[model samples]
Target: MTAKVAGIPMILCALGVFVGGTIWTIVYSFTNSKLLPKTQWVGFEQYERLWGENRWLTSIENLAIYGACSLILSFVIGFVLAALMDQKIRFENTFRTVMLYPFALSFIVTGLVWQWILNPEFGVQSIVRALGWTGFTFDPLYNADIVIYGILIAGLWQGTGFIMVLMLAGLRGIDQEIWKASRVDGIPMWKTYLFIVIPMMRPVFITTLVIIASGIVRVFDLVVAQTSGGPGIASEVPAKYVYDKMFLSQNLGQGFAASTMMLITVAIVIIPWAYLEFGGKKRG
Candidate 1:
């Protein structure tokens, strides 16, 4: 009873912090607050302004492109890596450690390194040219239509390792009896993994997806460090937009409004998944 009583206050305190921050953001979203908060309420004018702004619209579009590509690429690559690592292959620990090392590195460093490596004049492009491929040109980072994909590649390099770790954990936790049973039944290894293992790992996959989705929604550092919203705002994400408005552009109200929109967008995307995970009818 004492422990429960003591824990209640800490829980309440944490809830208070969360609720308080959310309310503060919501209130700021409704005002014409600049660098500093102002009490003057401007209703939903900030939201209206965002909708009418070209840059913000472009940022939203870019975010969608980056998010979709990152999510798909990360999941696919991570699953493949995890599956490959699960095989009783040589140097399993080395491969696992190599794959997961990227996740340990700071995103800032990842972005910087990738930026250098992808630079048209000095990186892969130059190296290819030096190899007598004079006509080769790898300049996606400079092209508005393709720059977002470049960012996605760098993001995947780091993000996939995270998903790989999660999937590996799920794979390790699977029952060895299932593998033996499949072998006795003459089921192919790939078929067993696809039809049996993958399905059983759904809960872990969903959890990893949610985590990656949150990262996608809140992605900021990679964009800033690598593209800085691009050669023409082609890589701008909602978080970057919010930062620009809050600091560089000095439009706190608009920044908070963008943040609110992001919060709503994330909620919309995640709520269905949450219900499916927690509220759906259970299967035996």
Candidate 2:
């Protein structure tokens, strides 16, 4: 009884913090609140301005590119790595440990490390030039066009290991009899994986998709530590935009509106797929 009573307050406090905060933000989004929230309603003025800004639009575009490339590349690379590991090679545990070590570091650390490594003066480009490739130029952070791709590479390096581990676990869960039967039927390994194994791992894939999507949506610390939306907001992301508007720009209303749009964007991406994947089963 005592434990139950204690847990009730904890649950209520959590709900108050999360649910209450969300409601507060949403309510203030319609107002002209600046620095501090006020009850002066403005009825979509904040949203209109948010959508009108070029930086916000750029942020949205960057997120789309990053999210799409990250989703496809991470899954492909992770599955490929997982398949290789499933081959019963020597020193499998050592290889897995090495591969997954990057995921142990936080995004801030990963970003800082990659930032230094990708720096033109003292990093890869410099090393290559020192080795008689003076004509070579590989500076993504300085170039506005390809800056997001630089962030993508760093994100993939830090994230794919976790996805690979997940894929490997899914692979290991398959019955050995399935492999034997496929082999006996003279089915090629690739075909077997595509036609049989992958379909069986749908749940694992969906779980991984959700995790990666959430990470993509909330990616801010890495961008802050790495590029800081450099080269004139080229690598700007929605989360960073929200932070800047809320704190840096001192426009709480606009920030709230941007956050709401982000929530809407997530819902738009996730809802239909989720319905097709899980919701339709109830009707069936």
Candidate 3:
């Protein structure tokens, strides 16, 4: 009872800061708020303008591509690495450490490191050109057509290691009896992993999906640090758009509108999942 009483203030403060602030933003999004938030209501003008903007559209498209590719690739890479690690090979700890090292770095650091490595003048391109292949052009950051893919590479490098760790944990949690039973039944390793193991690990897969999906939506720092949404706004994400609109562009209404859309989009994804995962189970 005493601990519960002590926690009341903290809970109230969190509700005020997060829930209250979200309500404020949603209310202000309906107004024509500019540099300062005002009560001058403007209905859906901001949202209309947001959908009509090319940069926002580009950001949405880029996000879709990045999210899909990242989701598939990260799971594939992470699962593959985890499976290999599960083989009880020599130096397993050392290999696991090396695999997870990239995840230890912040997005900012990962972005900057990849930026330099991908730079045309002094990075991979130059090194390859110096090796008697001057015609080789691999500068994705400079190419607006493929800039998002470049960012995708950096994101995967920084993130897959963490996914691998999570997958390794999930793999470790599986009952050894299951593996032994499958082996005794003469079930091939791949078939057992595909048909039995994966089905059993649904909860872990869902958790990983949530984490990666959330990261995909909120990706901003890496973009800022790497390309600053540059190469002609090709790599601009929704989060970057929100920040630039609110602070840099001094259009609070526009930012709020974008943020509200993001919130709605997330809710659209999450609410259904929540219902299926929790609500349906409760009913069951």
Candidate 4:
């Protein structure tokens, strides 16, 4: 009873700050609120305006491209590195530290670093050209069609290390007896990993997916620092759009509506996971 009483403040804060604020944002999204949140309700007008914008649609496409590539490549790269590290090879600690070092830096730093690296005149392209290939062209940041992929490279560099560490921990948790059984049965290493090990790591993968999905949904700082959604708004994302609307354009209603849409996207990802994670167990 005392513990429950002690948690009351936290519960109230969650309700007021999170739940209440979400409700307020959703309600205000329906209003034609400009500099201030006016009481003039405008129904779905803001949403209609939002969906009508080409910039918003482009942002969604960029996000989808980045999200899909990041999700697949990061998981693949991380898991492969973890598998290699699990071999208990020489200087494992040094290799692990080198891989994880980038994750210690903030997204802003990662973006700036990669931005310099991807610069056409002074970066990889220039270096390769200097090395005798006068016709080398490799500038993803400047190209409107491939700018998101450049940012994606930076993101994977920063995030793959963390995912590798998580996967390594999951791999370490598997029983040694399982390995012995596989070995005794003369099962190939690849088959063991693909069939038995991956299935056992379901919870780890789910947690990693949620973390990556949330990051993908709220990606702003990285894009801002990297390209500022540029090469002519080619790499714009939903969060940056909402921020520009609210703070830059001073269009409160539109920002609120965009944010509400973001919330709905998050719910779409989380609700199904939550049901399978908790509800299924309860029913069983």
- Write the residue-wise lDDT of candidate 1 on 164-209 in tens digits: 9899899998999999999999999999999999999999988998
**Candidate 3 error regions (>4 Å):** none
Query: Tens-digit lDDT track for model 3 on 1-284?
Result: 99999999999999999999999999999999999999999999999999999999999999999899999999999999999999999999999898889989999999999999999999999999999998999999989999999999999998998999999899999999999999999999999999998888887888898889889999998899999999889999999999999999999999999999888877777787787689878998
Q: How does each model score on lDDT?
A: 0.88, 0.94, 0.93, 0.95
lDDT of 3: 0.93
Q: What is the lDDT of candidate 1?
A: 0.88
TM-scores for all candidates? 0.92, 0.94, 0.96, 0.97
Clashing pairs in 3: none
Query: Candidate 2 clashing pairs?
Result: none
On lDDT, who's better, 3 or 4?
4
Highest lDDT: which candidate? Answer: 4
RMSD list, candidates in order:
2.1, 1.9, 1.3, 1.1
Tens-digit lDDT track for model 2 on 1-284? 99999899889998999889888889999999998999999999999998899999999999999999999999999999999999999999999999999999999999999999999999899999999989999999889999999999899999999999999999999999999999999999999999999999988998888889988998997899889998889999999999999999999999999999888777876886698688878888
Those runs of model 2 whose alpha carbons end farther than 4 Å from true positions after fitting are 1-7, 269-284
TM-score attained by model 1? 0.92
